[model samples]
Target chain A: MVLDFYFDFASGYSYFAARRIEWLAAAHGAKVRWHPVLLPALTQVTGVLPSPVVPVKWAYVTRDMQRTAQEEAIPFNPSPAFPQMLIAPGRAMLWVRANHGEEVAVSFARTCFQAYYADAVDIADKAVLLGIAEGLGIDGSAFLAGMEDPAIKSQFKEGNERALAQGVFGVPFVIAEGEPFWGYDRFGNLERWLAAARKVA
Target chain B: MVLDFYFDFASGYSYFAARRIEWLAAAHGAKVRWHPVLLPALTQVTGVLPSPVVPVKWAYVTRDMQRTAQEEAIPFNPSPAFPQMLIAPGRAMLWVRANHGEEVAVSFARTCFQAYYADAVDIADKAVLLGIAEGLGIDGSAFLAGMEDPAIKSQFKEGNERALAQGVFGVPFVIAEGEPFWGYDRFGNLERWLAAARKVA
Candidate 1:
């Protein structure tokens, strides 16, 4: 069974899930389809804006991320710069998938989340995307050239549309064989559902 | 330190927390201030409304609850009657608290949650509450009579208002002294907060 892990580079919980998604999927004997989507489009559809706009949500996300990171034994310093622009990195992610395989795209997504969340880097800038791409051993010029392509930009918009069509309203949403499960917390249940689906088939 | 446990009788996660609140509080040398408020009112103030009303939130809650339940090794059969109407039971909870001692009130709150969520008993009716009162050794007449009193009714409203004032928007909200922690998942953090508070004092 393959689980479609729909994630965004700027989401904190996505960072938490990316750290263990591969290990967990391997343990459950499930294949993961790493998906990158624009969080802004998702928010518009679900009436969920960037949490920073809502003070309560912002506070909740901050505390929530802290608790989750502590639970995962990862050092996470919540940045004030979050819910910032991800247009560059997001399009760059689409570029990776177009030029490279799913593996490179997924790895780049993981690196971007870590760079932004753990390393407290501003992921919206071209320099940051280039740094992330170079750090992952991908050719810098190809990645930069791909980022400027309108096709890569269109792919992100299409990905966002696909996510909206699937009724996904949040990041780290996993759709396993058409059953959409939202959030990092849903990973286990998504796996269970996938396993059950596989067994039934 | 005394922990104010804000909960509703109809809440599933509240039931999950109810069974362990007393023991856990006692273990940590913390006293429990059982704050029974109508979940709906709190939801309005906290912006945590019924899942069915918001598709994304609905999905998040379902998956999140399932994950937490499994991790806690608790049985979690999510009832179709989620975001259950608690107007009657909620008023009764306030009525009991006004006339009864803290311990009895707390037990009643816990039992109500347990009966509805854990035991699958119908707690939407007055008979169930009467039975619960009788079990608690309270005068069933006075308990029932108290529900009609204007003062008691007002207190119920005030409880909801107070919960909102405390930044609580959901059930099983624990306020360790003045620091508010929402849901059963925050229990461990509440404990640590109390321990640190005690050290400082």
Candidate 2:
């Protein structure tokens, strides 16, 4: 079974899942499909406003995200700006998808998560994006140039609209065999359901 | 330092947390305060209806609860009747608090978690509750009588109201010192915050 891992580079909880999902996917022998989408658009489509729309949930998100990171042994510190602007990283991801295959995009996405959650980097900044590209052995200048392309920018926008069409509302969402699962906490459920389905197949 | 564990007997997540909380609390040199409150009231105040209110969240909850239970080495099975009726259990908690100390109420609350999560018993049924009480060497009839008393019932209602006033939105909602931390995952934060407060003291 293929598990579509829907993530946003700016999301902390996605970092937690991104760190562990590969191992979990291997154990379950499931294929991972990386689906990078904008969280705000997914929320708007579900009629669930951004977490900032609900103060208490937003607080819970930060606290719980930190704890999940700690449990998974992932380094995490909330960005000072918090809920940082995602347009740049979002565009970079689309650029990766266009230039590279799914694997490269997934690797870049995981690197962005580490940069955002562990290094406390401002993901929205172009320099930080260049830094990530350099670390990934991709040409930093080429990546920044790709980020400027209108096609990549439009691809990010279209990804958000597609996510809404798939009925996504939150981060770390997975679509395994047409079934939707949301949040890092639900990854286990997605795994179990996939395993059970494998038995039937 | 004390880690206030806000729980509802009916909540699966709280039950999932209960198995390891004692050990984690001891390791962190923190005291556990078993504060029982109705979850529905907490949800209403936080603008969250219930776990069942969001289908995607509810799906994740069932899978995650089961996996976390296994990972924590706790016995648990997903129930069709999650967000269980707690009218009697809530009152029983308040009765223990009124007549007994917080220690007794907390003990009773943990026992209830075992009854539901580990043993897979129907906690809403009085007979099952009485059976659990008997195992604890308490007079089952007296416990039943106490659970039904009007004053006990009112105290549970008051507990629900107080939880809402405290800005609690989820089970395993924890408060360390004066700072509110929600979810079982935040138990460590509760510990660290208390440790810091102890250092200041």
Candidate 3:
């Protein structure tokens, strides 16, 4: 079966989930599909301030991300330009997916997350998005225009809508078969659930 | 090291943590100190609605708790009368602690959590709180009075303030030495952190 990983470039937990999902999917013999969703839209629908805007949750997540990262030995430094949408990077990845295919699209997604989280770069900036695209050998000036392409923008919107329709209300949401699991913390629960099916098979 | 468990009787995840922590602590050769905190008060200070009031979270939490509970095989049937505080029960436990001892207080807290989550009882009810007290061999008539005792009320308030001072903004918040961990999901992390210290010692 396939595991659908719905993530946002702005989410620190999603960064970790991306770093971890490859191995976990490999272990279970499942293909991973990365779908980027806009976190603000989901949070707006939930009628609560997004975690970063809420003082308590911001304080908790900043520390939680660092603590969990340190424990897992993952390279982490939350972006100085955090809480900003990576819409430009998101659209760029969508264009890459359409032309280059899933492997490169997934690579673009991972690099965007690494840029924002690991390298503390502004993934939302047009130059930074172009830099990431060129790093993946996608030509720069054309890729810059493609990030604003109407077709790719619609595709990004569609991905977010589809993720919401699949019952994803937060970042780092994963679906194995059709069962949805939210949070990096629930990764173990997700693995165990998958294992039960494996044992039965 | 002492693991301070900050919990509320209203929380289903706290119920699971209460069940799981004992063995985790025993395995690590650490002591657990249970601290009851008023969830609403903590949430109020956070300037956000509690999970039960947020539709997305309320939906996720209900499903997440059930999914987690089923995987772990814990006895759970979230209180039909959930989203209600167990204030009387909280005070009663404080009274039990003052009168009986920590052992009895811990037992009282566990029973209240079980009564709320497993049995679907309204733990906020005075008679229910009294029944729970008497079930544990405490005198029902005197215990009912003790639940509202001025000293017990103030002690409960003091306990909540102390939890806030320690940066507890959510249920199942635990502190191992000076490091704080939140949520039932973080139990493994807490255990791993404790294990590191154990090895060094």
What are the clash counts of all predictions, listed in order?
A: 0, 0, 0
Error of model 3, residue A141, in angstroms: 1.5
Residue pairs with colliding backbones in model 3 are none
Positional deviation of residue B15's Cα in model 3 after best superposition, in angstroms: 0.2
Q: Put down candidate 1 lDDT per residue, B114-186, tens digits, no spaces.
A: 6776566777778888999899999988888887889878888898888777777677888776667777766
Best-fitting candidate, scored by TM-score: 3
- Cα-based RMSD of candidate 3: 2.2
Better of 2 and 3 by DockQ: 3
User: What is the DockQ ranking, best to worst?
Assistant: 3, 1, 2
Score residue B103 of candidate 2 by CA lDDT.
71
DockQ, each predicted model: 0.24, 0.17, 0.51
| Chain A: TM-score in each model | 0.89, 0.90, 0.95
lDDT of 2 by residue, B95-134 (tens): 7767667776667777887777776667888887777666
What ordering of candidates by TM-score runs from best to worst?
Answer: 3, 1, 2
Kindly list the per-residue Cα lDDT of model 1 for residues A31-53, writing each as its tens digit: 88887877878877545557766
Best by lDDT: 3
